[model samples]
Target: MKFLAILILLLNILSAQNNIGIDSLQNNTGIKNNLSELRTELDDIFNDPNFSNAFWGVSIQSLKTGETFYKLNPDKLFKPASLIKLFTSSNALLLLGSRYQYRTEFFIDGNISNGILNGNLFIIGSGDPTIMIEDTFEHWLDSLNHKGIFSIKGNIIIDDRNFRQDKYGAGWLAEYMEDWFAPTTGAFCLNKNAIEIKIEPTKIHQSAQISFNTEFIENYEVINHVITSTKNSAVEVKINRIGNNIIDLIGKIPVTTEPYSVYIPVNNASQYFLNSFYEFLLDEGVEITGNAVKLDEYDKNYDFNNTIPLFTHKSEQLTKIVSEINKKSDNLLAEQLLKTIGFEIYGYGSTSNGIKAVKELKQGMGINPNNFIMADGSGLSSYNLLTPKQVVNLLAYMYRSSEFDSFYKSLAIAGYDGTLLDRMKGTKAENNFRGKSSFLENTRGLAGYIKSADGEPLALALIVNNFLVPSQLANYIQDKVCNRLANFTRN
Candidate 1:
């Protein structure tokens, strides 16, 4: 018995030298057989010149049987970038359930008679992040249509007094508001409260046709320097908005495409939406005497207070949003959803509230929330620190939840959609893996559970950090870990 034990120990040491993550799988009776191919694949991967200097880690577990198939340097903490959305969304589902909705309303303070508003009309916003331009306008127009009124006798009002309008997530990039990063709002925002500029090629003008679909504030100056006509078939478009509201276009306009639209960031979402609603009213033959203004305090009493129910603007379900934001790594939607999670659970507003909600949800999930330090709900913060072990441990616990289907489906499938859409293809890992990947300059991480070729389960969390190599090499190491796991066969 001693000699047999010595032989087993020798084999274990040899496997250890291979640096294969088969330590847990080795003793499993359900594993197909003693394996060496996983080690060989890992060796080839680690030895690759592409990953020579990068830091990376992986921890994989099987959902089929709830066993860790393999792991490599999985305990290391690394920036999760957008993977933090997983925690945010999971907490949202668990705390709020799936069917919750955000609403944008149209309220009135005056009487409606003779098809005209006798008082001020208000569009009350409780910070509905999903309120898009077309949708908001449509609701405004529809509200008028509902009243059988095309004109208003009074001013238009935008009540943006749900949360504090000045609140913006701290630690966010300065460029956050310059792009579709979305504005933090207390009242209302449409199409993320941005403007759209469309350029069309002209046949006779010294410049291309410049058009604006959204409210063009005086702060923005449009320079029509684009030159395009019938002869010059190629057209170029460049936006030179150099740190202010001015958008300078200096290029040719394409003739093949119809005038297109894009949502660019606006200065103040609450005010922007407020101004646009009036513009909509003017177009519909509504004339108001008073200027648009925000209420000092939210009106406690309104016409709708006693009115019967009418459908308000609703957002997409949390599950759908989670699938898009997590699997596809959508930055804006994920951030908004995270903020929404905060607003819903904490009885307050802002991303900080969302961060607090995340911590609480982690505790509720039986995870020591202290083990992870997430500064933001979207994982966009470099300060976000997470260990692969903690993530995998969460996955293991979630595997037994009643909402497992909703949670697992939220992950990106390798070789399919989401951030993993283009990865893990043409191998055993193809369509057999689902996970999230996160990276910053010097940090790298991959988390989620994996399934074996024979359909056994594996839960893995891997992170590599403090490396000086390019992140691409870290990603290369990440792919290597996946490749190694794909070769696993159950005994």
Candidate 2:
């Protein structure tokens, strides 16, 4: 009787194990079907007539299960534009932690005896891109005043040796300099290496009143040819920067129109920063006997034993800075961060060094180095080539990293904030998608994460190039794909 009872128990245990295996198989099959449906929907979207002649690359994967739900030419290269910021930003977070802060130090080369004996006031820049002239300089002046120094007996020397001499990225077109987005780079950047010009209409037939955002207005020569017209007249303004510091304003503006403003890139970022600092010192009642000059070459044997440390200005944390880069797609800031990463890792700041560091970071993340080419950190270069699979891979890797939260929050959220403020509103993607948007002449891309109906997270990369359709149409297609992903469910 005992032997028969044991045999029955063994049979029952085997039956339970078999049933569990069957249930697991059924769940896997259901997931597969759901993924297939998602792929079909996305394929239909890609097949639309508008994108039929365009080059499309897309990849989507479930972050929860590590399953690829959809792919179309996932390994093909395409221009990623600002979507390259994802790599720059993510690699930055890994190399320099979220708490990292850029420090700009002030040092005096000579001794100070009763605020009279001084040689050169050195401002060593650590590439703080967000340094505001008004606020930052004011703080520095206050610190100097507190130190009982009213007059400087030396020149203001700008030490920007941390970065190389190249002020622009590779593959940048000269015509692009006219736009505010293409500001020159510098170790010590002020106001994003650009200044704002405000033009207001005056009396009829009279030239418009021109004003500047900075007090150093004398730095630039503006030839105004604008005239005020009737209230109903068409307002047309043409701003042309003829040369380095010469700007011509030619157009007509209605008297009733509000003041029109435009931002122009500074020809010499280092000089502009120095000039602005000089103006601020004068405003703060600090007198300098010598002119501001750049330290182009420094003797290697120079001793700093007698130099006095005044004060250091710490910039906003990297977390906030990265948010600005990704949200607004700040090109100049992104480039600066790239050089900074290179400087931090290889002891020198240059575009090549930065790209090398980025490659190293990618390899460290277990991504194949040859899969992508990053010519510039901001993707402003046409030479930048990346595959959808590579982008999704980065997203997935960052999703599991410790710095994921910081990197994720830095992305633009649909219908909420950042570059996506006006996109995907009132749809399934609203407030459900967080990603970066990219746009060039004939290219558009959207890559990031979306939460599905079942609360499953999905990593996605959608890139379209050489599209003859309107930009809005491209954005619409990308939005539809995101919406479908957001509504995806396994029933």
Candidate 3:
């Protein structure tokens, strides 16, 4: 009788934990799962005109029990764009620490005789790109005019060695160079390495003249053929290279009281900087007779002299840069961070090093680098490609990281900040959704963490590629699918 009772008790215990039998079968072991049903719904959603031109991938993993909730073409690679910055910022903080600061040094090469330096001037750059963007050239000028140096008796030298000179990305789009998307290089980028081009109304026709707050660093002739338009639209005046040092500005001017000048890299950057400083000194009651010169090393003659120090310039905080890039989706900031990482890891500011670091970081997470092709930190490049599965995998791996808080803190919040500020409104996904947004013509992507109504924590990545439809339609489709996921009542 006791033996009979033991057998019955064991059977009862097995039946109690049905997850091993009925539960497993229901979750695709015992039977087909809701996941399969969700996929069908997703397909219907994708076929809608709102999503017809879209090439998309979505991977969702349940955080509660480590199960995949839904998936569609998760392995297909598509451009991730600025979403790639998640890798750059995360790895940078991981390997380089959270408080790493790029250094810029002021080294004297000549003796200062009665506040007059008789030696060459050198400004060494260590990849601190954000300098003096707060106002204009005047602030930068004042920062360097300290110690009462009336004149620089030598050439103005710039040590760009902090990052090796590699002009641009290897396969970067040709037309991208003309866009402000093409960033200015060098160890030190003053004012995002761009100058302001303003077009304000004048009392006379063709009387408009070019102007910048900073003194001219290089003498380049510029011709403005911009016709003033009667409309109040904002029109940009184009600047083109004529020969070597000459730039021609031509375009239509809108009837507005604003100034516009495209800030471009000065030709022969070293000499241009010297001339600019020289002009500033002249304005500030200082005279500089020496020309700009480039040399191999620090001038040994003036290193030992007790030269008076000029004013110092401070860099924008790393937190601020991250806020701009990760939270605000600033491509320029992403580009700058990539350059800074390249300089730190490979001794150069090219995208190659940044790409390599991201690849390596993915490998560390046990992922294949081929799953995604990273062209730049900012998704502005048409060349960047990432699979939906890869994005989900990255999000999952990052979620498990010890530094996950920082990573999450960097993402744009839904209906609150970043690219999703206007998305998921008036829905359960609102405020509950934290994700990154990507957009181009027919391309759209959203990936991040979420919680279903069933109280299940979930991680998801929804990517759309080749989207040719209107943005509103695409957004509507996304909203519908996301609503489905957010409303799930079970794991």
Candidate 4:
């Protein structure tokens, strides 16, 4: 009787195994069918009449199974615009580590006797771009006051040898110089290398009152020709920076218009830093007997390494800095980070060296070198190109990296914050998709990670170029595709 029971149990076990096999086969087939439908739907959307002249490159793959769900010219290269921040931020975080911090130091070349310094004060910059007027300058001045350094008998010197002097990136347009987004970069950067101008109308026919931040008042010359017109008139303002420090504001603002503000990029970032800091010292009652000087202009061969620093200002961690770069899409911060990486890896802070470091990083990440061209740290350059598959591959690789937490948290979540704050709302993809948004004239891109309804994580890259229609139409199509992916399930 015991032998009979054992045989019966074996027969039941065989039946259960057969049932599980059938169910697995059915589930696999269902997944295949759903993927096919997804492809067809995406094809229809890409083929819409509005995008007839546009070049679309898309790649979507499962992060869990490494399966490609869809591809359209996945190997074709397209200008990634600001989406290139994904690569820039990732490379920086991995190589520099999330805990890395930039140090800007102050040194004295001579001895201090009594309450006066007998030598020059040197400020050596390490490319901390987030330094603001009140936050940094005020604190440093207080330190000087507390230390009883009331007078300096020598000049204020700027030691900016940490990075190359090239302020603008390669391939940047000359027209973008006046815009805040195209600010010049340098080791000694101040106020993001730009100044904010606010315009308010005092009367219907009077020149608009133009005001700016006090830190730059002595550094720039403004020619305001704005006229306050009728309440119903359209607001048209044109800001142009002619020559080095002269800003021309020409336009008309309606009486009923709200206060208008614009940020204009500053020329000669190093000089701006020098003049601003010099004035701050004077205002704080610290007398300077000599003029402010740039070390490169005065003595190019000065050795900054031998001097002991008086005080050092350290930047926030790389994690927080990377968050600012990716989330806000800050071009200046991105460029600064690239140069910093170059300095750390190649012993130089030039853009060329930075590009070399980026190339090396891509090789380490197992990405093909021939797949993309990286011309600048920020995607503002038209020369930058990336393939959709390469972007998706990068996303997948980062997902498995130990640095994934910092990198992931830096991305803007759909409908939540950063550039993606207003995107993909009121849908399953809202708050579920974490990605970077890119935009340039006639170009748009979205790249990052999302999860399917079945809880399958996916990495996707969608890029559109040469589109003649309004950019909103392209956004519509991208949003639709994300919604479809979010609602997809194989059960």
Clashes of 3: 19
Query: Per-residue alpha-carbon lDDT of model 1 for 249-359, expressed as tens digits?
Result: 777655554664444566677777777767766766666676676664344454456433323667777678777766867665666666666667765556677788778
- Give per-residue CA lDDT, model 2, range 1-491, as digits (tens): 98897677567544533443243111232333377776876788789786788999999999999888899999999999999999999999999999999999888877777865377788888878998877877778888877777788888878877887455578877778667888777687888888888889899999889888788753678888999999999988877878766888788989999999878887777778888898788777778898788776444445657688877889999999999999999998899999899999998888788889999888866678887889888988988999999999999999999999999999999989989998777667878899999998899999999998789999999999998756776777787788677767886
The lDDT-based order of candidates, best leading, equals 4, 2, 3, 1
Q: Estimate each model's TM-score.
A: 0.79, 0.90, 0.77, 0.90
Report lDDT per candidate: 0.64, 0.83, 0.64, 0.84
List model 3 lDDT by residue over 460-491, tens digit each: 88777776544555565665566566666644
Candidate 4: misplaced stretches above 4 Å?
A: 1-33, 215-220, 243-245, 256-258
Model 2 residue 64 CA deviation (Å) reads 1.1
Q: Supply the global lDDT for candidate 1.
A: 0.64
In model 2, pairs of residues that clash are none
* Candidate 4: residue 201 Cα off by (Å): 1.7
TM-score of 1: 0.79
**lDDT winner, 1 or 4:** 4
Q: In terms of lDDT, which candidate is strongest? A: 4
